[model samples]
Target: MFKKIKYGKIEVRSQTLVLFSAIYFAFILNLAFWRYILGHVQINNFANFFFIISTAISVVSAFYIFFNLIIVPFAAKPLLSLLLLFSSIVNYMMFSLNVFVDKDMMRNVFETTTAEAWDLVTIPGVIWVLVLGILPAVFLIRIKIKYLSFKKELFSRIKLIAIAIILLLIQVPFFYKSYASFVRNHSEIGHLLNTSNYIDGTIKEIKTRLNSNHKFIRLDENPSLVLNDDGAKTVFILMIGETARDANFSLGGYKRNTNPFLRKEDVIYFKDVKSCGTSTAYSVPCMFSNLTRSGFSQSKARYMENVLDLIKRAGYDVIWQENDEGCKHVCDRVTIENMLERKNSPYCRTGYCLDEVFLEGLDKKLMNIKKDTVIIMHTMGSHGPAYYKRYPDRFKIFKPTCDTSDIQNCSRESVINTYDNTIVYTDYIISSVINTLKKFPNLESGLLYVSDHGESLGEKNLYLHGMPYAIAPEEQKTVPMILWMSDNMKALDYINYSCLKSKAKDNDYSHDVIFHSLLSILEVKTISYNPDLDIFRSCRTRRFPY
Candidate 1:
């Protein structure tokens, strides 16, 4: 049985080598896939054996199905070995991180900069890749093969395929109901299969991005605006908040006073607002683009300028102050100040600048603009698992906070406490921005605070954001939005001040409103602007203020 047998150019040591290799590879390499199915599918006493046999058959049959479809006929032994080794590496990463590979994660991989890549490098990651990927790859590359005739090789391959199909066919009648139910109930299990997840995701990402580039229809070649500007210079500030969920916001009626400062102010809090996507990489650009959430296309968004660009075209000086990684290319043509690069600033510590750092020289930046201006402050708000690092020591009001970046290691209570503290700190930051804007009373100033997306706090064993939007929990989609305009700013004739009071919490809104609302408020007239999607539409008496 230990003897080597040859079939064409391929060599197998006994037929047992082929059978054992197929079973071993399926079971070992797909541990994550198996674990997911086992946890999700119900197993009654009588159905237990049925599920087990069905799963085993599915794995073995899938292996042969793909092998005969691709590897057997097309790939030589060496190439097939390389592909297997590469897949093992991907499996190790996914299993260790508890991440599901989907289009968004693939987008993240392609969009990841060098600085962001460091977060993924860890001791466990290194260990898993070495044990699961490199060792297997070395063995495969070093192995030798014996040869046989082409006819014999084809016969052997067909025989193996036939056997796998027969076994799968036999299981269908006995366990068809259980198998169908499991697959239907836990559809995501297919994405966890080794190599298939990333392969499918990558292909999608590439196709979407490629098609997305040429789809942009310019909003306005030369935008014209009618300012409700009285004697004061119109100043509009947009705060792009990060990873903040409405469930944690005190303004949204959360149990905690996470937004104590903002609550004290006249913030028109929008209660029912959902994000376009679950990741910053997707949400940032989407929110700023002049496209409705329902009508939005990633392919089209990448090509056009956003609300900021339209505001600039309307003759306002646009400045972007970034404390996060970036404004996701929305600020490319605008004047940008990198707050995180201000290493000498007090807000800079531990290779990251606190959200307050975004305000360091805001007053001076404002002074340079003689014309009406729009300033965007993109903050690193409540981004975890380093929740403790987000706020200053004094703002660590939530006691026994989770200090470690590894959130799962901490108790769920501690995670919530720490995360809430970050929200409180964010409140202070927003209030501070409002206070600073107040100092320039002569300027017609207003601040609109909206988060790119929301976060999940260990709900149902899910620790973070970026679950596919279609199936994501409400906690990951619902975000907090606040608008505060100075009395002078609200006096803009086109803005119906009554609407802000009436629609503060009653209506359902989304990132769809951001684009149209900004254009309406700024009084930028363009063909792309749709009043129907604007939250302020009912309040506006006219498109332009005389």
Candidate 2:
């Protein structure tokens, strides 16, 4: 009754404890991968929670495996590992998130509503789930095939002590790994908060940040150059947009003549403009901040001066008009954005609003201001899944539309046509703004149009944008930028139109150049202005200054 066992009829004793430990270890590995996917990567607590679940699972599993492995012969699969494998898979599913996955909501999870639209138009978390999922089951099945055996006397009560020790030892590593990951994760969040200030100052030095701190800075005895023209009567509107591709625009030279009305206006179209980012969350913040595309990746956005604050300081009236529903506050410090963004209505939709809504009060708002005013008209141009949602009902130019929110149900061609239709509408919207600006007899009005980021339209079977910037496709990088000057502004010596025209078609332009170009056009000067970095300085070449 002390120690007697047979290993598949081989006379040597079977070390069932080691085999049980290996199977248990494999299951823990499987579950650990799942925990990472569900965005539930707590430290020891998560591991411990799963371990407790595994223990409960093992209770039922022990009985099943014992009968299946010993009493009932030829099961081919290991009982312990099978429980471990299946349980681990279920746990992974529990941790799955929709943020990193594409359309995973069709699975009908308990956690359907997300803080993000289309979980914020980002990739769903299921990509990792599938890759890490099936291997555990396969490995566990193989382990059972290779390790099934019987130990006759060692199944006694006193031997239970050794079995308990074996389970605990194998379980410790998984618990420790989870603990380490959690510690690292929390520290990263802490770092993001800490670095926000340092980054803000550096970006402000270049005049590319939102200028949230500019008010506090202006309070200083020696302040930066201020945007307040002190009643010179100037206005500026910065249209912070989202996920708009250059190809969709009629003004940007799309074959569809999407910007049909824009062509008749006096706008300088920078046909070869490129975007710094592919996603709105990443790009919009970066564009407003002074950080370069290369610098944005290695650092956090918290410490930069967004462009709006600089505009405020240079003495221009600043306003943020937003149509993008999911847009974040990159210009928060400079001016509070007036919500052109629509609330829920029959025509009002989720994730974004129509370009028409943005135009609704623009003319009225323009007359109210006497300062050299600036207005940012944020557009919901071509932000997808429901690309047709960005435009009004009348803009549905393409016949046989796929105007529903469920993107997959619609054909790819239908989805693209609907998206391009929104581009067509965007073309009209920009032209209308140009016309409104022309009404001021004494005003030297100009408009600088830039997209927050570009989008992907069915390239390599990829539906949208935001493939890490390093691998972002051309459709997501090439943006269409145009600067329109009223005849009054150019003819009256407010700007050198011929010089701007020379550089408009150059391929080396980027959002980086906008920081300096805006200041050049507006006539603002700061101590930190680098002639080489500023777009209008004589030292800068015909190409890009940034």
Candidate 3:
């Protein structure tokens, strides 16, 4: 029985408080973890039932041990309250969105802007936290703790820790095969473990930051531009799209006409393309670096020379027009024009801007081109759970759209419709860029649009992306890549457009192709340029015209 303090606060012994807190966390805070285990592991026999019981006991023991080690006499209630509140939010994210929190996902969380964070907030989320997290936390904070003498408390804690460890270890021998098989097959199960997942992710991210080398390795210091003798200025636009998946695109044979504008344009839509990573924080830098997806490291990539650096060294004026999040340090050395800062009346809103913000003064800039230039326009296309906010009113072609951020509450039809509308708007943005490129016929203008990564909209109960790459669904991996070339650009590189189109249809490509393909398209001669990875290399009639 609990003793009543002066302010009606329940006074309990430290050991009792720790035990109750651990039980609360194990049973209440770990719904997703228990759900995953139950769904994946069958309990057809008594042995299976015993395994489940053992697993539950082991989890509770683990929590008990963890709390005993971390919770001190003075900070016990405050610490438990905070953990409960945070665990609730994490649980909501995992249960509602079906996203796995890993190191890269933590990096995404750290790098997320205020506006981006607000997009994930919803009424249901608040209510869930209030009921399951805040109320419990308030109750925990109001509890008073009665501790024993220091020596006795220490002895008691040590004994309890020992007991918990024995409880955790005793089950392993009996269910060794079950444990081994479950762990081997369901590696992603670790991500479902609530407090452990985010805590592990945060620690790994911090360690990466501490261990990463600050000095950048220069790939090519003296790369040269090998322009055609015709003396026409080459204006290549690299448009980095966000979250636009091929499955929703009409160009890739989706039943929905999500690409009405792109269908009319003579662009080569590469149907089968995979992203470097499932998150923007990983994929954007990985695609720009000379390193292939297998070889890429974000830590190394931040300090290393990217394609933009080589292009700048090769004597072309390079500008990064960012409308999405930060360029992930890919455009660090280049001239960056944050389009979101422009606040153009037609395109700009409270904190974010439309993709059309990139097109505002594009024509004038192209017309006044004084030299060969590469303009990298990063667009915020189809980023959700606020899919309806991505596009304008006119581009809401898909009917009965999901307008709220609580997309879990929305019907499947409405969610898909809302997501499809964003793609349609993206189609308009890309085609508009192509049209802008067409107006500047004197310049050898061309455009390459590739999404950083794809998205998930309630597919297999998964919502937004950031699933670990190894276990990610095809919805989060298969992105759309489109290329548009002017007649002048075709002549400049001696590229057979028909041949490229033919290859685009049947051939598969990934983000690894971007670095080398950009070099090929820009006529940049460097040792880092791998002709083998270049998608346009086979279509070119001649090599670099140096």
The candidate that wins on lDDT is 3
Q: Model 3, residue 173: displacement in angstroms? A: 1.7
Q: Write the per-residue lDDT of candidate 2 for residues 54-106, one digit (tens) a residue.
A: 44344333433343334223433354345444333333332221112111111
Candidate 2 is scored at a TM of 0.60
Model 1 lDDT per residue over 264-320, tens place? 888888997999998888899999987667767666777888888888888888989
Cα lDDT computed for each candidate against the true fold:
0.77, 0.54, 0.89
Worst 10-residue lDDT window for candidate 2 reads 97-106
TM-score of each: 0.87, 0.60, 0.98
Residue 120: error of model 3 in Å?
A: 0.7
- In model 1, what is the error at residue 417, expressed in angstroms? 2.1
Q: Which stretches of candidate 3 lie over 4 Å from their true place?
A: none
Per-residue alpha-carbon lDDT of model 3 for 311-370, expressed as tens digits? 999989999998888899999999999887886558999879988888899888998999
Question: Each candidate's root-mean-square deviation in Å?
Answer: 4.0, 13.9, 1.2
Can you rank all candidates by TM-score, best first?
Answer: 3, 1, 2
Candidate 2: Cα lDDT at 82? 53
Top candidate, metric TM-score:
3
